[model samples]
Target: MGELIRLEAGVEHTSWNSSRTKMAAGMSDGSVHIYEPLKGTNSDYSCSNRWKAHEVAVAKLVWAPSEYGDVIACCSKDGTMSIWEEIEDAEKRDVWQLCARFADTKAPVLDLQFANCASGLKLVAAGADAHLRVYEATDVLELKHWQLQAEFANAADVREKLERVSCTDASVCWRPATDPIQQQVFVVGFQTDSPQHSIAKVWEFGEAHQRWHLVAELSSPEHDYGRINHVSWAPNIGRPYELIAVSSSNSLSIWSMDIPSGPGQRPAVKLLGYFTDHQPGEVVQAEWDMSGMTLASAGADGVVRLWQSNLKGRWEEKSRVVGS
Candidate 1:
């Protein structure tokens, strides 16, 4: 029941704008294609433009909110991250231009996400260096100017010196902002060969200290769920605590974290639910619905499964969609 658009180049990653009026696809040949709906057509899309984005394969593409004015950030296999913006030309047509490029990373940038919060616009990038780097933009119009705010390993203990572990991949999800008084927080999951270091960690930006701090670790010693492949923070509309879903090699776990009400109070994290039976192979991705009431996960078995909580607050399988 879905419409398809054929492209000359093979796409490796695709992202849609927040307004849903446009879409961008990253090609396997390190190029990016921009498409928009054709005029007076319902399902037809035309490629508006194309550009070479990176020297290596483009791994990910994410668009900023409309308030940011048609901006996108891309991560590549060449250990570089770039931000591009669409500016109107003299003829009133849009032109895509590179706003900034960051190439200081030692390894490939696996994942990057943008968070437009009350604090400001922030970008978090995870790479093979075993570090989650944060960047902040003071002015919204100046998308090119960004300051490196913080860099830390995905671990609960920040003071201790942790050796650099080879991170094969990582996922970063920003906490949905509901309360203005709540501190800014995001979750990072590291996929590494090191069993002791492979885990999910929640990081919070401390306003008082002007730095970032690791708040909670979302794992237990009793069950070692191998390298995490995906993580998604649900949008909490009325829940007292924040909910996050993380997927490992074969299992998916949902965790609830309570925000501290006062100073010097640490956040408490508890495993709310977990799933392993529904998926026959490794779970590659997990996403939460808009209301945070439902979860959907895709596995290597080529199937999509949905999960929801019952009246008793126990999570159960809701439905399944098989893939060809």
Candidate 2:
């Protein structure tokens, strides 16, 4: 409803984290602004500690696991990521402590995410250069620190078919909010070519085999072209398994991984529910609660919406943050 914090050089992108104590805002001038939203009033939205986070436009912001506390990772147009933390000790005041910083490639980074799935949770990030990188984070001396992790090379065959595919990075998300589901599968969406359209892939990792295997592919059924903006897995409650939901340019679709049909045993994706507010033009962001029971959505219309289901197990608009 009001301005939380205005960047002196203007802002580029912003993300709300699962941890209510933190916020990551990217600036147009290649820096990231970090803040702790104060509870209680008109002045609360403001970020308490603001600083220069990058050398180029910070294109994406992602907060690490809450278990890690105060760690945020940011991607930049310059092909670098900065993971930082706020030092709240009396000696540091409001300054930030740099946990990690490095350049993986020269490709512009677009999005970042952490996987909560089984075989140990992993942190994943993608950039404009068509690189999907995964990191195996370790908790040392009770401090959670992320390393080079691992990098998934570009799909060479897929890149050759599309112009600049190697430079275009994809977005990542995991299926199932429950600890049970998270430990089983990892999902990611890519901006691919026509006919190929966009793709959502599910991967399963074997701890004993020390290998990550491809489980399923959620591709465009009718070759309809809509770039996936984000993907989420609804919390499995009262239900048997997890439900995957993906948001695109103009539509939102939900699929049930529990129900299998046909020979391939592919999951069924139903148009469970969707709403398009013409005024917004586009749906930009979305997320589920920690339990995956509730969903929140935001669009260009500047309205924040929450969706829940009725007794019939159908999704419905439950609440909204309007005109903010």
Candidate 3:
């Protein structure tokens, strides 16, 4: 275990560099801080630089792929998003320069993620408007210029009535690509009273149609988990099926989805486990370890729980850590 390192401003979100050498934290004061480990120390860290990145609290921060250099994206409470690149000034001091800004966002961006594809780097942002927008960098070297590749509603049957429902939050996760031929895929869910808008849906970019298509919906006729709080698509190792964790106000559900063997084929989804021991509406995040063998979930109660499958292949809580 690493030593405890605390921040004064309090961090709302954090993203580590691809190499894990540095971390970018979004503070409650609308500032972004970069921290790097001290030499010969695993736990000790030093804040290398920090700057005010937004006018309001930062809602989410995402680090671009290492191939894009030291670039990070941040969204704020004021319904805006921006991209930053780490650069050295004339004085040889490290600085974060604003490269791109979304000044005309229709609604608050709840979450954002970066994915690498065959064409180039793509970014997906989910908004309180119940829509997911996809953007692609025009030039790999130029972080300032990006083109809106696609924009579509995340849920079905609510495209024209967006004003009737209000979304509080949303979560998104990209499907880990295991093959070069795999197309772009992601899962997104919105926190809203509208039933359709609250369900998690899987989308895939269709190569032939040049648009995104709904591949699957993690829904069942027997149950409806209200207003998804988080969605995590587990990393695929050698498993024949894929695993996805979706959390709501009621329970945390683990699903096993079959991989499509051919193009335009929809995969089948089966509910593997549903656990509701955590405090309702307090579940914050769910993530999988590198091997995709163990699951870790955190809640607002300051408890971090680890879960795994038993010998019978049934998912169960293995351990937990209560934060001080």
Candidate 4:
């Protein structure tokens, strides 16, 4: 066994950039380090630029899509979410700099997303207290809008009578592939420390007020998968793009929307796939490539596995790279 020469220490989390040009890592010491990997070499092309991004440990990091340029979104234990974009020097090389600090809440924001922008452009966060707050990102000083999405708090829901299950472990909200209604869709997982089933909810824009409404709820019949981990979009997004999600378990479940056509077309979601292979407790993260044809997953067991469906349309394991 040889050493992992390329390893960077102190990082509590990492998020890959959409362009694949750079990636950001959040350190336990409250710093954010952005690294650009060199092509055809195991070594990075340049020195990592580290900055004090948070007052306490950086809890989660997510890179904005390339359409958003150098911007990155991060949530920290200090109870804030910040968006940073590079300020380039005269020579045009990136000199990473702070773009904007969005908002500070009373509780730590564990997970957040920026996918609603194509419609109304908003920022959403799931805090430790188990509330999902959605905010409009704009030049206006005051928060344009905010709503506590859920609260499953109670004595029975509390594990130690202090922490409860309505608490969210992670969250992801994405726009549907199509824009028939001009409103975005959101999916979130809710967990309480109680004996009841944890819930994953679907939300859509309401008939009036431009407000969001809960449309669907997903719960295990046996009530097992302890915490909802992450929700994601299916690849090859088209009109009403397919949706997919995964949890603490090794399963990858897929869903899709059936938009009605012509004069009357009510929408519906089809369960596309539920894939499970990695050993329990061995899997960590899952992502679909832009095409939705391939999936990448990695976890605690130290393996990065790639999966794909052939032209014939049967899914298969393509490759597995050992993680350092």
Tens digits of per-residue lDDT for model 3 on 109-192? Answer: 999999988788889999888888899999988889999999988755456446465789989999987887678999998899
Q: Rank the candidates by TM-score, best first.
A: 1, 3, 2, 4
Q: What is the lDDT of candidate 3?
A: 0.87
Best by lDDT: 3
TM-scores, in order shown? 0.94, 0.76, 0.93, 0.74
What is the alpha-carbon lDDT for the whole of candidate 4? 0.61
Q: Give the clashing pairs for model 1.
A: none
List ranges where model 1 is wrong by over 4 Å.
7-9, 158-160
Candidate 2 regions exceeding 4 Å error are 1-9, 37-45, 88-94, 116-121, 138-149, 153-169, 180-184, 192-197, 220-225, 259-280, 289-294, 301-306, 316-324
List the RMSD of every prediction in angstroms.
1.8, 4.5, 2.0, 5.5
Q: In angstroms, give how far residue 107 of model 3 lies from its true place.
A: 0.9
Candidate 4, residues 1-324, lDDT tens digits: the string is 643234367778877776666667888888898777556766454445778888888888887655556667788877887777776789986666666664557567878876634543456777777556776655322232333333322222345346443464666666534543455666765444543334556666554655565555554453345555666655545534454555445555555555445322335655544555665653466777777777777756677778776777556679998855
lDDT, residue 53, model 3: 96
Overall lDDT per candidate, in order of appearance: 0.85, 0.63, 0.87, 0.61
Model 3: weakest 10-residue lDDT segment is 155-164
Q: State which candidate, 3 or 4, has the greater lDDT.
A: 3
